[model samples]
Target: MGPYGVETLPPGVVDVPAAPAACRAALVERDRFEWRPADGGDPAALTEEFLLGHGLAVDDLTRPAGHDPAGPCGAALYVSAAAGAAMAGAPSGAANPVATLPEVAVVVYGHARPPRPPRRTEPGRWWVGPWRDSWTPGEHADAVQAVRAAIGRGDVYQVNVVGHAAADYTGDPRPALARLAGLPGARYGGTLHGAGWAIGCASPETLVEVTAGRVVTRPIKGTRPATDAGRRELLASAKERAEHIMIVDLERNDLARLARTGSVRVDELFAVRRWCDLWQAESTVSAQLADGIGLAALLRAVCPGGSVTGAPKRAALELIAAVEPVGRGAGMGALGWVGPGRLDLGLTIRTAAADGDRLHGWAGGGITWDSDPAAEVAEAAAKAAPVRALLAG
Candidate 1:
């Protein structure tokens, strides 16, 4: 109806096929680009150009993430946005608290796929120290109050408050990290090991997905312990519902910017879903992409996703910069696959990173006018618990 080439269909991961497992991925040379957001450039657009220039369209869906170096061409992709990397304008690309990776990195595998069947890695015994949080409860609560006051002043409707935690570790982190890759209901779950850093994501939220011409974003807002009672509580909580809908509206607008006029729609709203032992509220917003829309334009339109930032994105970023301590490291941005006209990137919420001798993780939630500071703190803990437990093991 709108454009692109994709047929009109319901959006979200429900409509997405299980991502082809990158069982054995070989990092062919990554043609690197150095675009830093701190210098007033767009991280998304840089990655887009890299993706397009590589003739990076994947057609061999049957092949695993990679095949024999000389095997018939097959394609797949994986990208990581370092912490809260934003689009053109507003402030972002804060120093990564632990990892030294670029603010945004979009990688496509080249030749030299596989010379032999990849051997399954047996991670070595590891020890993780007690994690030290970047902010204390009092500090976190104060930031929540700060956001609420900003809302009171009409600066913004809502702002997501995030905090970081890190601990020293020893030995191989790959095994424990592998757990993050298969998290229940994780649309984009996997571990990517780098030179001295590795990222493990168990995120259950979709930042954006484009199939054919339709673009969809699933912004998750509410969180509760997974229980029959929690389900009832999440469904009945006026505050949770309010947070959920605000993001749904924000996403609708995000898609509208790149979509054909009058093509935006909310395909699903406030759907209760499970991620680990927690209950999360999610909604799908979609639109038919405008004609001649390229990857660069798409990333510019939606870089720091709404669910992670807040409504009136620029204003929220300003407030967030002033209040939060430390950077997001490898969390709170995008991670997942990108293809010719299709991509499935997850908002890196429940994600953790291993940088050298330390393991890092981040967690938090949206703050609104009705938020309770203590409750918000506890909720962040609950969201972070699974990742911490996995690392502790």
Candidate 2:
């Protein structure tokens, strides 16, 4: 049993209805904090009342959320490290605790935030509806151009293209997400439903897992449908090889910033792994972060992963900032469970976002000098299929 009032349950276990209410109470009862999500509730306002009611500093509340472009990229909220520390048996904020949040795996939890009905500033609100807008074909083309430029400079070869579509929704996102889960050849697949209207189903090929003192990151660079077995050579072609190497090198450098000098190493190079929906070639990079490296540093070091951003990360980021039409709120963010002395996070990809009435999602492919604009455009559309079909009907 934990002081926070949660007890350990069995694997594939779940907490009862009272769990979330109690967890919310733990923060709301004693602190002035807010847990607003893309959906709507104002945990901040509730936290304020709790702080005033109890004797606590509002700053004591910490936010344990971030953006990842590869897995379920987006902003997330969680019990701060301090909050987790205060609660006996609670995991660190850096480690994702969603799975343990009572009924997360079994019952659909609340949206990332809460549903904001209608207001003067924003009037559209709905329940479980298509809430996303599509990017024009030209804009999509420009994105392809940007990727080509990166490839021309030998920065990267292929980057996955994710298009954005927003929606206002109600009801459990599980059904929508389950549409793609376990799809043949889709590696690192899963859905992360938040407390708001935000939800995403990602078929990530990358893995960032932490065990004991070791941290491992697998940068997946090649992609082709498993059904197209004959295209293996083309899928892992020379151009894709260069792209994988660039990102792998960038990852090595990023880890070096926090990892012990000389401890960083590439465990594997261009190994092909088949998943539910696709076949991918990925390289593994491992490192030992310096003693006392915190979550913030580790994340900051490799955020907006090289696979999406290109090599020379800072430059690619500048490019993204210049060309991307909107801020990638949660697109390309990371999500997963983390615990004391251990953590596991996946890069967010194949995702969607929703507000009150608008639902959005995106898909794109990496472009190099050898890349075909037409192919890239088609790739983007292909990635959008799962979400588009969901929004259509």
Number of the top TM-score candidate: 1
The TM-scores of all predictions, comma-separated, are: 0.86, 0.63
lDDT of 2 by residue, 310-341 (tens): 65655555555555565444445554543324
Estimate candidate 1's alpha-carbon lDDT, on a 0 to 1 scale. Answer: 0.70
Off by over 4 Å in 2: 1-133, 146-162, 167-174, 178-180, 184-195, 228-231, 390-393
What TM-score number comes out for model 1? 0.86
- Cα lDDT tens digits for candidate 1, 1-393: 011111121111111112434423332433434344454555555555565566653332111242344432222333334324455367653467864544665445443434234445445667889989989999999999999999999999999989999988888675676677566877677755445566777888888887767788999999888999999999999999998898888888878888889999998899999999999999989898887676667766776888888888778878878887887767887777664445677888888877667888999999999999999999999989888897788
Model 2 scores worst on lDDT over the 10 consecutive residues at 1-10
Cα displacement (angstroms), candidate 1, residue 66, comes to 16
